[model samples]
Target: MKYVTRTCYLGQISILSVAITLTCVSPNVVSAATPTLGCDDSMKTAFKPDGNTTVLLVKKVKKDDPYPSPSKEQQIFPNRPARFAADLCWVKLLVGPGVPGPTGAPSTSRGIGIEVWLPEKNAWNHRVHALGGGGWANGYEETVVGRMSVGNGNLPAPRIAAEEGAVTATTDSGQQYAGASFAMNPDGTVNVAGWRDWSYRSLYEQAVKTKALATAYYGSPPNYSYFEGGSGGGRQALHVAQNLPEQYDGIVSIRAGASTTSDIAQLYPELLVLRDLGGKAPSREQLEAVSAAAVAACDIVAGQHLGFILDIRRCRYDPTKDAAVLCRSDGGTNGTPTCMTSAQALVMNKVWYGLTIDGSVPDPALDNGWDAPVTGVRIWYGYPRGGYIRSLQGDLTWPEMKSGGPDIIALALGNPKIGTPDFKNATANGEDGWKTLTYAELAAAYQSFRAMQSETGGDPDYNSDLTRLKISGAKLLQVNGLHDPSAWVQGLTEYYDRVMAKMGGPASVQAYYKMFVVPGMSHGYFSGAANPNANPPVPADGQLYRALVDWVEKGVSPDSMVFTSPAPGSESSVYKIYPHPHGPQMSLPACAYPTVATYFSGDIFKAQSYKCR
Candidate 1:
């Protein structure tokens, strides 16, 4: 919606005086400063718009300083051209060529100055739609626009323009800060203002504004609108669906968290555990041992020939008993494999479980690949202790490896917890309660990693508002990579369950939501032979993005999309897409809730390999 600036406190005048003055003023009196338009001339020109849909060319400002100043370090690789900085300014760009209509030529408009992406267009018979991306905290106006250009060669406004032959606008949440405000200091400390602006409020505000802008630009409200994002962006998709459902007709949240706090909190426990190990780096032996133990525990359940636990839901390890085997390897040289020590095992277990220190049992249905035992060669480990030493450069020195532990620990402690209701009661038994520590302790630790999280601003209880999102008629599609190493796939499932519970149950939530699990995809996208060391590859049958589009546009709800590995031939270029039934069944009916996929009959290598329920 178009924003109008109103002076809330002019020279500290009392509200009563302002109200009285307003009553006495003429109805036509105008006093606010005129809105500015256009960017500097030195930069590339993108279109800027006044509150109305009028378009003008504006110079772009770089999001950050061209070079690292004394306050900031230089970007490691500055390959991309610098961007325009539009902090607090209002700018607009023209997307797509104007088309002559019955009345006049129609042009699409978008806001560029603020962090959000807003697109709008006006045509009598046309419609308007807004798209949301993941990581609302991160500055994505450029990224989203760039990706759109690369993938579909149409900016959001133009894409929507082409799709519906209607006008459209998108936003980057009008935030000045990049997502969250917390940036690490040169010495690796958190920056505060950076943190607060980057919190959930930015994304929430973006969603709200998208609807407002739609109403303002179109004269009439959008007939139908959709929100889409994957991973962190997926979380934004869920947030809109859960918190502002009536605003949009469809939402595609691919791999979103149920609670932002819980998701972030879950990473710390493992980081803490790893830090306690006090090694320069886990020896090759240690990595192998932990990987091996993990596989043995859950690989069979994955029903894959690779012998790795492809999912996290099925992993079931008793920390007390599995702890020993988990850390059989500890300190060793780079060349030699070593057994994990007790302390090391504890850390690995915690990492596998996420940062949740509480006693809440993990959902049995989520097949976390943590339990897969490491039998094959270890590909790599996290940053070597001292600094980033490229693998191609050779093994890192012991002292260098050791240097990373403290920082890793600090990051673990300081990371923000994913906000979820389950976390509140995690440690109910006094000192032994599931979550045990107070919110203050967690906040302080999170400050150490990224100080912006300590601001305690934004809607911490946003996840609890799913009912409101549903009431608004939002549809959600959640996707996750089963083998995601960054955020556990289990966490995504946990978030989905929380939404279902908040809405009563699966059947009740079914009208608004759907979840899909990608077999071999990584955190971002499918990595293949071009990037062998990537975390996960899209299976032979996966077409995750296409599936999302189909669900959003064609009204064909995805039950299960197929995944296959690339064969050694030209035909291997083609993907095989399959559909699995939704809900529990005897023969691996992608079971719901507590039911897990377990082997019942037939050869494990075949699609008839196992059953879930």
Candidate 2:
């Protein structure tokens, strides 16, 4: 695991005096990482009884004890191995699948599974670090999509906290089965309680009970608390911040583009693009080649070969125009090693356009129009060109995703009765025709979804006015990859802009909430395109975690950070997710959003050679 020191993330700070230079952060220095709670099931009843929550198992675990592995971890991190950090009292609890009315207790619906790790007391940081789940998971994975579902959460937020001597917890979010399966009912009706548990209740209740359990273990409540997650976990971070402002002192959300929900919504169109027109999406090879071609087309700035698209929203590379580069194909299985069939190209175009009124690409220039985050431009976002190809056609590789579009529409509309809305054949009025939905129809669906959700006591997607979070002095830090295929940076920028306007412009928001949009990084990894010399992405869960701790404990906020990539062929791949140093030759400075890492005259791999302008 990463043992990053205090001076690790300040982005090559040799420019100033070495003695007084502001490293700008602190390493997680817990004297004793795990706590020793010497008790058994009897200790479970020691804490006050939760309304409908049950402490299923309470076991004492030793540091380095083998953690129960998840069934499929490669889905989250195709290449990384998994490891659990520090240890102590491992508490597993179940929350009601039942919610939404006077009878908010357990019912026939599926309940949530939560795991809390109370670190060894003497060395504990007296902080509660609650982890949010990913994908369809209410627990870890896009933050599954963790347990072996999403990359072991790319070695998630909880591991870092637990190892560093902070109290940590994770949840299954009801659908331990993961995804939208829990939202569907036998009679084709909406499972309101299941939806509530998956969307908000599970995560919220997980945090509430987690804190309560921590309080019981430590004798008093924690001095500070933070929520960290990416992808689905990213959504959880924002949900807690907006709905229960007092729950967490900070939110480290990633991949929460659109500032609404998981970019999972983007999958619907891309899936339809391939399924409807081409009959099946292009093979993985074609998708990767298309991404490479797009990267090559846009990787230059002022004649400098930067290897990755700098400003993705402004990227003008079009798949339809790749005829000169990619070989020709017939849209079905006719594609060759480097050839893309006309139908395949068209599918790419439609996917890029997303669920729009007409199948047309939005102008790159008009992205920053007068409207904040610009509503009505399109119903949902499309995957970014040159984004991770694996995320493209490979998303449906998971069995949970085959019917993704229909399921999303069903859940959002809360109409369990909709029963697999037609994709290829949208209805005349276009109520649930997700694939063929017109812009007006799509907008109405989104509105209807929001309206339905609002009636359920809380609307996590809306309410950007985080005046309460700010008043309580809670900080929010978001880290996103500019070219993330699953969660585009466009939505993140829009959300930041909206919150900035509501909370007194950029300056005020930056005070407590700041976002770092990493160029070239894809979902937490670097671009798939062969950029041998590009800087490795900043450790999202590692360095970013330190930055948040510094902000909360030391009052130090980061302005820019140095990104370090493994040498040309040496991308660091340790079994543990801890942030260790990677070497050979890769270092670049990624500036905070609104500003990008602009290349200047010098060594391409050095941070000093680039200006954040």
- State each model's CA lDDT, in order: 0.36, 0.57
| Candidate number achieving the greatest lDDT relative to the actual structure | 2
Task: Please provide, for model 2 over 242-328, each residue's C-alpha lDDT reduced to its tens digit, 9 standing for 90 to 100.
Answer: 655566777788766233333334544554554555446676666766766777777776676666666665666666555654554
Model 2 TM-score (2 dp): 0.76
lDDT of 1 by residue, 156-206 (tens): 333333334433344444332232322322223343222222333334334
Clashes of 1: 114
Give the root-mean-square deviation of each candidate in angstroms.
14.1, 10.7
Angstrom error of the Cα, residue 265, model 2: value is 5.0
Model 1 misses residue 130 by how many Å? 4.1
Error of 2 at 166 (Å): 1.5
Task: Name the candidate that leads on TM-score.
Answer: 2
